[model samples]
Target: MENAVLLNAIIENAIDGIITIDDRGLVESINPAACSLFGYTPGEVIGKNISFLMPPPDRTHHDEYIQRYQHTGVPHIIGIGREVKGLRKDGSVFPFMLGVSEVTLSGRKIYAGFIHDLSQQKRAEEQLKDYATHLEEIVDERTFSLQESVEALQNAKEEVSLSLEKEKELSQLKSRFVSMASHEFRTPLSAIQLSASLIDKYAQPFKSEHIAKHVGKIKNAVGNLTTILNDFLSLEKLEAGRVEPSFAPFDLVKLSEEITEEMQMVAKQNQHIIYQHTGKESVVTLDQNLLKNCIFNLIANAIKYSGENTFIEFNTEITGNAITIVVKDNGIGIPEKDQKHLFEPFFRAHNTGSIPGTGLGLNIVARYTHLMNGSVDFKSIVNQGTSFTILFKRHE
Candidate 1:
């Protein structure tokens, strides 16, 4: 009996909670660890009914379950660790794991059980589940915002393309209007000039100052009309791609001198002109009329914008493999803000509002320069002067 008591003492002090019940469902023995697991002291739970540790429905049904199991000796979850719930002495419930084993002693049945508390583990798992839900929500919100930003960018690009198409249509419309205006105004002005000439001619030689005055007005109007018409025709041909390049050997020197001489008459009212050739007499391959037009137009523009008697310089030089001609003037220069638009069709300087112009001269000259495989560049200082440099390939 002493040996049996000592062995029972050894099993009761184990770290793992231990308990045994008879096949009749009565508490046979229990350990100190089992007592601590259920909030009880040793001997306080030893012979108590095992149903005392189960909750309401389970407590009432446990005896019937044991009776059924003893009759059949069939197995369910016994002899295996399984998660379950346990009721404490204070009526608080906690999660636990349970395992049971059955044995035969003296041809009678016995049972043993192990129990583990899981309150802390349950709390940790709940916290992890909450964090996962929050992370999923954050990812969903950012993905939605990114989709909105992409949609906005696509919309902006479409708007820009539509605006560009409208601008192209407006440019073509303006060109048509200018062409129509030139045709409409030129016919009436031509009739008036012929009438004035006939009156000056075969109608008796009147020393009448009034006749001379009237004829002068007719001539002035005709000249102004012609200038406008010429500008219109040139701009139209340039824009329509009618100007073709015909390269041949030509006298750049004589062409330069002739252009300057004609432009000198036009410049007489505003500026003085000087033309100089600074290199060996050289012949270059280029279209004579186109090159002449370029020089004449440059001189005409310089003489128009400068102050009275301002000196205009026309210079030509043969440098390396190119012929460089420069047209410079001491005039009211273009503003910095307007420089970027200088070569654009119909772009004029702000200060030249009172000056007579069609606003397409530089654009034409630039196109002709490019067609001849050359480059045109200019420098201007406001209220000071402007100079344009034309570089043409000077081939032998």
Candidate 2:
């Protein structure tokens, strides 16, 4: 009696739908879960054919299948489980898993069925598939955009290469033109300088200070033109990449002394250039011609910018692995605004009012220093003075 009561309680409270049918496929019992699944009451389903709860073709063949199983001892859904369709009282169709088992009670055969609803599980699976499809679409769009950006960058690189090539060709043409023009102008300039010197020599006999004065002006003008032409020629060679440094062992002290003597001859009245040397080891390996040109440019600038009777200091120092040369002058120094561009080609300081200059000197110096693996730097305060320093690694 206790076992019967427990079994009845489990079946009545079971979560899955449960049903019992006779051998003729007539419903004998139905649980509350089964009633809820089929939208029917126990009074409506009990004593009716179980086929009424199954949809369509299954409803028609259900009774025949049960008779075949009873006579032939063959089992279709009996003792087996499969997914099948069910019908509700409202004519709605749904899917479920059904398992059937056969039992004998009081000389009569009965079949029990268990139904588990599959609607919620099927819906969740479908939603996962849709989300996967959406992710694939987003990945494809981002890949296409990345490909387009790479192609655009490639196009920009090609354009820059073409522009650089054109710029190189233009620079070559300019260099050639300047070279030709400098050569052409020098001949006439030389003739004018010679004639002016002769006129001054001849007028000295007449003792006429007026003719001497005018001749001096002519000589100075011719000299300035010659200097400008030389600057242009030097710049042309440098831009054309023709100026190569030829390194050799040379005496730094001797070179500095010779340069000082040569430049001192051209200094303004009462202006002096003081030369000094540090460290007894004066020999260094460098391109002598290039070094001379760099030093010459700096001292010339000092002489030109400084007031008459001022002193220009030229110093050279030799230490372990380093060689330094400094040229400082008390001259009309560069302004703060113009100092940043001092080494750029054709850049003149704003403080240079009425002072004649081609503005290529410091630029040439900087390039020459770089060719020899050296560096050049300067400091200047307006109306006070300017100092330029060049340093190189001493090659032993």
Candidate 3:
């Protein structure tokens, strides 16, 4: 009685579905779990063929398989386990694992089969596959976004670097302007004051030569002031885009001669400007005023920077399509490091010590040359000399 009660309790509480079949493949008994698993009750399933719980093919061949097994005394599914489709009471099919074992009681053989549903495990596998695909897509999107952010940061960095360079240039220009005004203006102003005082002191005798000497000194001071003012005005006009070229045909040789003569008055003591003309053609069509300013600035620089008794060569050459102007001076040549920035506004060489200059001469010359559609190039050696060559295309 106790063994019977234990077996009934074990079958009733088992997690897997359980069923018992006779040798004829007929269902003899089923547990409550089996009834719920197949959507059936114990009374409805008892005395029915076990084939009724399997879908077609398996249901049709089940009886033939049992008969073959009994006649041949061979086991096919009687002691083996496999996965197969099961049909529910509602006629829906699902996957389940079936394990069958043979049992003998009172010289009659029966089979007990255990069934495990695979639906939840299959669903969990599908969910894991879907999550893996979703993760890959998210990673790809983030990688693309990160690349775009890096490119944007690089562009922003370049823009900031350009802005800093421009700010540094402007600050240096301001410093040059302040230094130029104080040093350049003081020299001429002091000379003019001293000359005027001397002229007044020697005025009583009315000595013409002494008075003339003082007058010459005053004139030179006035000329220096005028040159500084002109440099400032030209730079302002150039920066404001207000200086326009007026083109005309002019004799290059005559222009060079006139400028050289004018520059001689301001030349250092015992220094002279030698004018030379070469090539066949002398006339060219260009902006004469702008060209004049360019030539004068070069010659004036040559005169100012050279030592006393040095000769400045002002040479000009004209060809069929081009005109070249050369100004060579025996002066304190520009340092190699300062040559690169020589044409920049307000830039002065480190070697120009105690030289009264606004540092705008070469910058203005470059601007004027550019306006005339010309190019200027120079070669210099420290303590030896400096030579500048300007070339212009002859406009037909």
Candidate 4:
């Protein structure tokens, strides 16, 4: 009597729902928890088929399953736990875990089942999935923002590097300009002063030839100053983006002759300029003023570098859309080492010892040729001679 009372107390207080069914699948008893779990009264479930608490197709197949298990003595869900849906008294359904076991009293067999609601567990799992998805989205957004920031920083670094390079180049140009000005200006200014004093001394005696000689020296000195100023001005215009080519049709032969004629006054003693033209066409379209400056620089350089009695050849050739100008001089040529820097501003050849020049002639010529869409090249042999060629496309 005491053992039976203890068993009844345990079944009544158990947290999980408890159910007992006969071998024929009839519900014989239900604990209070089982009644509340399925929204049923013990009187309503007792003596009813156990399939009443199960939702179909479990309800439809429950009786057949029990008959097969009883005949074969094989367990499908008898000793194992599984999840299944239960039908409530109000016809509502919910998930639950079930475990069944078989017991015998006398010749009668009974099945007991334990049940637990799984609603809370299912809700928690769904929340975990949502949280993971939101985290991944936040990480992707931050990674994209970081990539953009890196690219912007890279562009800023490149801009800073380019600015520094330009600053360095400007600094070097300024240093070269200052040195050239001091060296180039002092020589001509000193010559003009000396020549003026000598002219004053000869003025008291009034010798025509002597006074005329010093006056001629002053003129040449002034011309040298003009050339130097022009070079500086052209360089400034180029750097300031102010020089643009203005093309027009003109006679190549006439232009060459005119330039040669102007250079004769400054030529060395007994020196002569020989001009020649090849191809039928002597007329071409080009930036005349720029081309004239280029030719004048070449011819003047030839006269300045060569000795007395040397011949300077000026030749022009026109073929289809191309024009070529050659200036060949029989003079002390540039050394092999100095040829590479021939077009650099303020650069002078080592072989030009004591020569009176500002070292800007070739550099200015090169700039002028570029403005006119042309190229200048030269070949030189030490102590032998030098030749310069200018090639360009005809403007029209």
Q: What is the lDDT of candidate 2?
A: 0.82
- Residues 237-290 of candidate 1: C-alpha lDDT, one tens digit per residue: 776778998999877788788787877876656567899997786577887778
The model with the greatest lDDT is: 2
Using lDDT as the measure, name the better of candidate 2 and candidate 4.
2
Winning model by TM-score: 2
- Per-residue lDDT tens digits for candidate 2, residues 294-366, read 9999999999999898999999999998999999998989899898899976678888877877778999999
- lDDT of the candidates, in the order given: 0.74, 0.82, 0.78, 0.78
Across 28-107, the per-residue lDDT of candidate 4 in tens digits comes to 99999999999999999999999988998999998888888788976457764698989999998888889998888888
C-alpha lDDT (0 to 100) for residue 187 of candidate 4: 72
Better of 1 and 3 by TM-score: 1
Taking the tens digit of each residue's C-alpha lDDT, what string does model 3 give over 1-396? 999999999999998899999888899999998898899999999999999999998999998888998898765675445888889999988888888998899998888999888777767756655644554454345435433433443343344435545755644553464366447655755665675566556554544453455355454545555566567667766876789988888988888888888889778899989999999888888899999988888988898789999999999998887889999998999999999999976677998886756678999999889888899999999999899999987655
The candidate, 1 or 4, that scores higher on TM-score is 1
lDDT of 3: 0.78
List where candidate 3 sits over 4 angstroms from the true fold: 1-205, 208-218
Clashing pairs in 4: none
Candidate 4 structure lDDT: 0.78
User: What TM-score would you give candidate 3 relative to the actual structure?
Assistant: 0.49
Q: What residue runs in model 2 are displaced by over 4 Å at the alpha carbon? A: 1-166, 169-173
Q: All predictions: root-mean-square deviation over Cα?
A: 33.5, 33.0, 34.0, 34.2
